[model samples]
Target: MSDSFGFGQRFTPDEMASIRKSLRDEARFGSEFIGRLKRVAKRIPFAEDLLAAWVCTRDPSTPRRVKLTLLAALGYFVLPLDAIPDVMPLLGFTDDAAVIAAALAAVAGSITQQHRDKAKEMLADL
Candidate 1:
C-alpha cells in the first residue's frame, strides 16, 4: 500500500516495513480476533470494547488516526507473544487490556453508538 498519511511525512525503510506489517495484520484482524475471542470470551471483560473498537476501525467514516490506533491495539491483542504472555491463567490479558484502554482513550469519540450496537449484537451471538 502506497497510501500516505497526507502530512508529507517520510518513513525509514524499517518504519515502512512495520507499516506494511500493520496493514497486513489489520486486514486480517477481524477474523483472527473473532477466532480468539470465541476461545477467551469468558475471561476478558473488555470483549465488547474490543469489538466496538474493531467495528470503528473497519468503518470508512472513522478517521485514519483512530483506525490506526485501534488497529495497532488489535494487532497486539492477536499477537502470539508480547510484554506478557497470553497463556497465563489470570494475568494473561492485562497488557492487552492496557493497550486497548489507551487506544480507546485516544479515540473515544470515534466509536459511535452504531459501532457499539454492532458490538453488542456480535457479543450476543458469540
Candidate 2:
C-alpha cells in the first residue's frame, strides 16, 4: 500500500523516499519552512492544515511512510512553481490546499491530537 497522492496522482516508493529526503534536508537547512507558513497563512487557505502537516514531520512517532507522503505535500507548498502560480488573487493557494488535504488524508491515522495541538500553538503565534 503506497501512500502517495497529489491531485489524484500517485508516486512510486523511490520517488516518495526522495521527496522525504528533500523535505528533511530543507527543514534541517533552516526554519524558513515555518516562516513561510506564517508569512502566507493569512492568504493561504487551509494554512492550519499545512501547519499541522509540518508539525507531524517533527514528531518522533510519525511513521516514515506517512512522513514521506506529508513531506511531498510540503514540498509542493514550498515550490514556487506548481500546478498553479501563487500570485493570482483568491486562487494562488488552492493547489497547495488540495495537496495538504490529500497528504493529511493519506496519513490521518498518524496525525495525532498532539500534532493538531502543536499546529494550533504555531498558528496562534503567527
Candidate 3:
C-alpha cells in the first residue's frame, strides 16, 4: 500500500486518509456516477467474463505497465477516489467517468477484439 507512483514520490498515510475522507464525502454524488458506470459496464457485451479474464491474467505474462494501468483504472472503478467529489450532485461523477474512460482507452489495445466482441454481445442484452 506504500508503493510509489513515480520517481521519488510516495503517497503518505495522511494523504491516503484525506483521499478516503474525500471519497466518503463524495459518495452521495456517486449515485449518478455509479449509474453511468453501470451503463458502461452494460455496454461491454461480456463484461463479467472479460473482467475475470483480465483478473486471471495477473501473472508475469502481463506487462508491468499494462498491469499497473489496469490496476489504476480498476481502482478508479472500485475505489472512491475521484478528482470531482461525488457529493456535488449531477456533475459530480463527470470527472470520474472521464478519468475511467481515459484509463480504459489507454489500455484498449491490450484488450483483445474477442473480448470486445463478447462485451458487445453482453451489452446488447441490456
Candidate No. with top lDDT: 1
Best by TM-score: 1
Instruction: Give the whole-model CA lDDT for all candidates, comma-separated.
Output: 0.82, 0.77, 0.51
Residue 70 lDDT (model 2): 85
TM-score of 1: 0.83
The TM-score, computed over Cα atoms with residue i paired to residue i, of candidate 3 is 0.44
> Candidate 1 lDDT, tens digit per residue, 2-31?
334343344467855764585684447677
lDDT of 3 by residue, 29-111 (tens): 34543454466664433345335334423445555555555544444655555777656766665765565566566555566
Please give each candidate's TM-score. 0.83, 0.82, 0.44
Worst 10 residues of 2 by lDDT: 1-10
Write down the TM-score for model 2: 0.82
Model 2: per-residue Cα lDDT over 21-58, one tens digit each: 66666645236667678788887668778888888988
Question: What lDDT does candidate 2 reach at residue 75?
Answer: 83
